[model samples]
Target: MTVASITDLDVTDHYAEALHEVIEAKAEHRAPTPTTGEEKTAAPVVDLMAALEKSVADARERRGESSGGSEATVHEMPAKPKKKTAAKKATAKKTAAKKTTRRKTA
Candidate 1:
């Protein structure tokens, strides 16, 4: 099998560019236009921390959980592995302690 080249790829590039511009212009026309001549302003910067806190509370409220201020606890989002491992270790220690106490009393 033989592969063929179109000699000048620039012609194809120009057509592609023109077609993209036409499609974008048509799409802009289809969208609703604002009546005011004033330019649309970008949205205000958001405090991500505050927004996340509110979101968590809202979600907890929907789940029928208490959204108390003093009792509010934020769990770490990223998995450290250390936390779960530590929890397992702590549980094991407690069980071991109980077994040792039972053995000593018996």
Candidate 2:
């Protein structure tokens, strides 16, 4: 489609038109007209926590685990301290000797 001028553009806003009609009806002290077609209903509310628990129970049952049986426990171990290598030991000794043998400057 080609437009010769800015006025040729299709700028009809259905929402604005409907709002204007409602305002006019209110000014005349009459009820605003209801929109035609089937009315929409809100979806049923869900219990998320209960649904998740049931799902987990179903999965456990499928996996041959009893609902009231013992559950697996996890224990975390403390990480072992790293041992100093021979090169690191030598570097430490050198650093200590340098600090001890340094002369006081005036």
Best-performing candidate as measured by lDDT: 2
Which lDDT tens digits does candidate 1 get at residues 20-87?
76777788886433333447889999999999999999998999988886474788888657544434
What is candidate 2's TM-score against the reference? Answer: 0.39
In candidate 2 the C-alpha lDDT for residue 10 amounts to 71
Evaluate residue 34 in candidate 2 and report its C-alpha lDDT on the 0 to 100 scale: 73
Global fold similarity of model 1 (TM-score): 0.28
Local distance difference test values of all predictions, in order? 0.67, 0.82
- For all candidates, the clash counts are 0, 0
Report the lDDT tens digits of candidate 2 across residue range 1-106: 5567756887877788789989999999999897574579989999999999899899999999888856779889999999987664543445444445678899
Leading candidate by TM-score: 2
Worst 10 residues of 2 by lDDT: 90-99
What's the TM-score of each model vs. the native? 0.28, 0.39
